[model samples]
Target: AQSVAQPEDQVNVAEGNPLTVKCTYSVSGNPYLFWYVQYPNRGLQFLLKYITGDNLVKGSYGFEAEFNKSQTSFHLKKPSALVSDSALYFCAVRDRADYKLSFGAGTTVTVRA
Candidate 1:
């Protein structure tokens, strides 16, 4: 089984400041981690993914994540946040041998101007 956790329920940051959404996972085998953001009434948008290759993975919306095997963490980070970046963020993970993807409860981010 695979599961993901976003310890924080909400993250508040000022515009132009760095933003981070923490995530940790547990899996039976190797894990495939992913980050998604959802705006109000919108579907989840892919932010980043860590399947293989380098430890650092970059994806849409100027977001990046680092895959830490030892700690089983893949926290999302943005160098600077924009007011428009406010949304609900999700951390998901799937065991390499499993077909199901388990997602966290989600963390809401509010970027204030």
Candidate 2:
């Protein structure tokens, strides 16, 4: 079985400061990791993915994630966060053997000016 965990329930950051959302996963084999963000009353939007290749993957909205195989982690990071970056973030993982995806409980990010 595959599962993802967001250790922090919430993360707070100020405008123009670095923001990070922690995530770790466990899978039977190699995993397909993904990060998604959802704003109020909106569906989850794909932020980035680590399907293969580089250890660092960049995605929408100036976000990027580093895939650490040994640590089983794929934390999302933004060098400078904006007030608009505040949202609910999710970390998901899918095993190559399965079609379903397992998601974390979600972490809420609050960015203030």
Q: Estimate each model's TM-score.
A: 0.98, 0.99
Per-residue lDDT over 1-113 for candidate 2, one digit per residue giving the tens place of the 0 to 100 score: 99999999999999999999999999999999999999999999999999999999999999999999999999999999999999999999999889999999999999999
Taking the tens digit of each residue's C-alpha lDDT, what string does model 1 give over 20-76? 999999998998899999999999988889989999999997999989999999999
Cα error, residue 66 of model 1, in Å, equals 0.8
Could you tell me the lDDT of residue 32 within candidate 1?
89
RMSD of each: 0.6, 0.5
What lDDT score goes with residue 106 in model 2? 100
- Stretches of candidate 2 off by over 4 Å are none
For candidate 2, give the lDDT of residue 22.
99
